[model samples]
Target: MALLWSRISSILPPNEEQFPLQFSDKVESSVVEMLKRSRRQLYCDTTSTSRMLNAQIVVDISWERLNTGTWRDVDKEWRRVYAYGCLFKVAALCRENPSEDEVLQAVRTCDMGLLMGAAIMDNILQVLVRILQSELRKTAKDEDESEHVEIKRAKIVSPHVPSIKEDLAIPRMKCPSLESFNTNHLIPLKPVILEGIVDHWPALNKHPWSIDYLRSVAGCRTVPVEVGSRYTDVDWSQTLLTVNQFIDRYILNKDQTSQDGGKPLGYLAQHQLFDQVPELKEDIRIPDYCCLCEGDEDDITVNAWFGPAGTVSPLHQDPQQNFLAQVVGSKYIRLYSPEDTDKLYPHQSQLLHNTSQVEVENPDVERFPEFAKAPYLECVLQPGDVLFIPVKHWHYVRSLEVSFSVSFWWS
Candidate 1:
């Protein structure tokens, strides 16, 4: 207990004033009290069981309030309460024999706090999460080496090829210069497939984004996943799951069937995952082409798209320029110009106005007669390829196999 206390103390601020500027005086005082109570319990010669039980009771009340209120309406102070509750839980567990699951719970709790809580408080929780992750990694590595065990790798699925006309294909360029790209594509609002630009990324060569490697690095981290078929479907919904659980049920399970004997697709789409697990961020680099935009580098938004072969992103348009980089497997994509907006039937509702009501693969020619005459371009994106999509260009994407892609969006 003393050793654990020493390690945690080193990470904590020396005084309340050193806490994040966003923290109120009341929250600071509450944190100081909790830390004092924990320190006494760890250092005293005799254990005070009643003090620990009282702390648990306080945490329970906070948890109930947090679960009851509407998420956006809930007071921010409740996040602080829940975050400290998790810290106290970790302190209690460390006082006795603790299992690996107990430690993982601590890491997950901190991650949740960061996800839902105020970003200003991230400095404290992010460091705590790193410490817990390091301990888990070290323990797992030691156990593996001691047993001399070998982990079996999963087989890669083959990509599905689609037939298309060569005349309507998107033009391809091999690492065009910044000036040339601006003159040919950016100014004209054209789409093009770029090669040789992302071949040097570590995710492509040095530390290839294989299934096993992703599982090893981020299996335990919690992430939100989209469930059901495509987002346009009536049954579509979202749920949270650990990275390992998602891989096991969605990626590894060949049948891709749900427990209720129905087929449901799971997609980890449009998530800023690099912010959650910084280690994975080191494997990829931002393209220098983003400099053309008039903003700081931090203004760019990066998102990860990972799922099985049949996953589909319905035909929709984005307001910003996009560079979709494929790190593994392949995808078949189709694009329509914004000028043909009336040709494709876009939904009337504000929520889905950007998404077309017509399903490109199985369109109703009678209901949407103009759609048949809409001119478009198509391409099959391969690994290490980056496709530049102009702003407001209606694009549709379908993964050809078990795939992972990262997208960069900027003005």
Candidate 2:
């Protein structure tokens, strides 16, 4: 054993013992200035910040919860309390002291500060989701525990818009046909899909750098993930597929293989894509954010798909906030935590860093008992809808029908 250990050590190349996560003084100063500017904007356009916060959700996590019960009297307080603690502390720095005009101008001019604000709001979105889901589970559990409790039928709700085809007419839209939702759309849908600062752009004809149709047109190496397979959730031996038939025959069954309930769908693993696309580069603007670190070429090999009435994308967090825009079909998103490591059931080793450990629908508390402790927020995105995924939050996606989403990092 000693000889083997020595040989292994010898074969390993000497490298930096540790890479510190240090921010340069300039970056730190820039963050502080941006925070200040954000506060000014908050004072001027109180609702603008509010609306952005409503656009999405974020989470601040740590590996503290492992048992079924509370920890040091704080766990009983709920996860929201912990995440907000992080958000307010960060936001407060920007609001130290502000004059009315300066605050307004700062709000108007502070784009970078909005990133912090967006993150803060993202935390709120997470907390709300956790609490609401917790309450639902509590109520359900309580009802189950009770004897002879009354059960009522769920209420049906109607929509304000006549149909998907109808336009949202407003005084701002004298010509309803040309009316655009702009940013205000995310507000009404706040408790749903979008939970952070909402931004919109005219839909592009295709992904900025994705090669979506290649698999359909070419032959590529592929790995088969069969139903009931274990630890097969994220295998990425495929370089490309011959066509949709190849996926249907080989990949669809992999859904049942999971450490928790079942593995959710994932794009081609980063390693598989990166090895083939060395020309791929890190995103120049947000280099630190990409999950694959493939720069602009990530979409070339990272794209994934799902069939109708199926589940994919088990709850997991990544390094980047994905700009997940749907082009073909609709799907549902349920998100989890960055720090709630125990509940999500992270992979046992180093590769865990690259994948979320959480399972998809049909969560089984018996095996992954701690999963019941994790809180989640959900949204259903349709064609042309976009979702911004902050780093390290667990998310599960269920396809309503044949679905195609183009996911890319925004630097």
Candidate maximizing lDDT: 1
Which number leads on TM-score?
1
Question: How well is each residue in 1-411 modelled by candidate 1, as lDDT tens digits?
Answer: 135445665776565456433345545566556645654554444453644564565466556767886887667776666666555555565445456787677677666666665443445667766777776776774334421221233344455599878988989999999999999999899999999999989899998987778877788888889986589999999888888788877876644554245678899985557888887888988998898987878989999999878888989999999999999889999999999999989999999999999989899999999998999999999998999999999999998887899999999
lDDT tens readout by residue for model 2, 190-219: 112332211222222323222233231211
| Local lDDT at 300 for model 2 | 30
Q: Given candidate 1, what's the lDDT at residue 164? A: 71
TM-score of each: 0.85, 0.36
lDDT of 2 at 82: 27
CA RMSD of each candidate after superposition: 4.1, 25.3
Instruction: Give the clashing pairs for model 1.
Output: none
Give the RMSD in angstroms, all C-alphas superposed, for model 1. Answer: 4.1
Model 1 ranges off by over 4 Å: 1-6, 14-85, 91-97, 120-122, 141-154, 254-261
Error of 2 at 89 (Å): 62
